[model samples]
Target: MLPVGAGAIGTQARTADSPVMRMLDELNHPATAAHILAERTMLHMLRGHCNSPIAGYADTTPDGRMSLFGMVFKRDGSAFVRSHAWGDPSDPATLGSRVAADLLHQGAMKLIDATRK
Candidate 1:
């Protein structure tokens, strides 16, 4: 899907390393975070400042392709959907980052949902 801020993504392009990747490195899934960091497009889309663990898992296709799903939260407790490609549908290795994103996004979503209700 086309990201909302196409120009917002490259704002960090000049950085020697990705901030998202650096943040993810501090988490349980460093590789997953790194993947997200690599995708500047996705990073630009995530403007939320909330930090919490999200619940998630990667779904693998019969052909070994993985799809990551999850949500992101903002400091005010608002959240938006986050998703990514996990590469080969059936590969477990490709599932690592996707799973991490799912977990993080879900947890953030719940927090945002709770405050709104």
Candidate 2:
């Protein structure tokens, strides 16, 4: 299995409007686009770069609710904070931001800081 933060880099590249995003757009995958957008929004809100020990995932239910899960960990993997939030799917950013806020409230930044060194 991949490490906790493995899914983050690809999303960061896509967020940079790289060729991968172009390919996904050309493939006409709106759902995929939306999902990635929400997940990336969480990463952005948390100030998480690909190299950070931070991981996030977001998804929307068929009924239009968006849910986001985020985690931050120390470099040694000795501690971590995780949080989740849900909201209207159409406003994915709100859901993502809320989850990030929750993580912050749980002291995620401390873990992130520990990882940076």
Candidate 3:
């Protein structure tokens, strides 16, 4: 099997104003929300889909910073590119975008595109 890797599971909600959305937001934990936002932002930036050979995870540090890790792999696991970074929890999207840029710079798209064939 491929080496063990990080993963995330999340639920989605409508961004439009609604009672349910407000209630969910009120119930959400700040750190958990930050982590999810960062991970999803990275995946969106990479155009990753459910079947894609992509992985992303985000978590909070002890000092309240957010840490993000992302990876994209070849279909056969023969090659891959990964990026990791730390950023302010208040702007997790920026951190995600930064890591996505790093992976793209490392030629992650070539590996990702090969999987489509």
Candidate 4:
């Protein structure tokens, strides 16, 4: 499946004033943008991109806590490391940064570097 294209469509689907966007907003589901921000922040800290073998996901609980997961993989898919963290939903950037730190401490950066050799 075209995850990238699908992501683009999902982004557009959340645009303000659209019917879907309005419904989501009314339903308190506007957290998609927040999740994106958290994931992007984590990726930035890891120096990863959409084309990289790095992945992350973030979400908030009804209690207002944000959880994030980050993973980095070797090019041949032989090795990887992943980490998870939680923080205040209003400060998702911190949640992401912490998760990235955990992954790095787990030697995720080493695996990523190995892939370049």
| Highest lDDT model number | 3
Name the lDDT value of residue 47 in candidate 3: 74
lDDT, residue 94, model 4: 81
Clashing pairs in 4: none
What lDDT score is found at residue 78 in candidate 4? 82
Score every model by TM-score: 0.29, 0.72, 0.79, 0.69
The C-alpha lDDT values of all candidates are: 0.42, 0.69, 0.78, 0.70
Give the backbone clash total of model 4: 0
Kindly indicate the candidate among 2 and 3 with the higher TM-score: 3
TM-score of 4: 0.69
Segments of candidate 4 deviating more than 4 angstroms: 1-29, 115-117
Give the per-residue lDDT of model 4 (tens digit) for 2-117.
11112522434646668887665565544666677777777777776455678777768777888777778877878778887778877777877888888888887777666555
Candidate 3 to truth, TM: 0.79
- Which model, 3 or 4, shows the larger lDDT? 3
lDDT of 3 by residue, 1-117 (tens): 222124433546887858778877676677777777787787777777656788877878899888888888988888889999999999988998999899889988888777677
Candidate 3 runs further than 4 Å off: 1-23
Which window of ten consecutive residues has the lowest lDDT sum in model 4?
Answer: 1-10
Q: What tens digits encode model 2's per-residue C-alpha lDDT throughout 10-106?
A: 4234478778777755656555455567666767777776567887776676777776777888777888888877787677767778888888898
lDDT of 2 at 43: 74
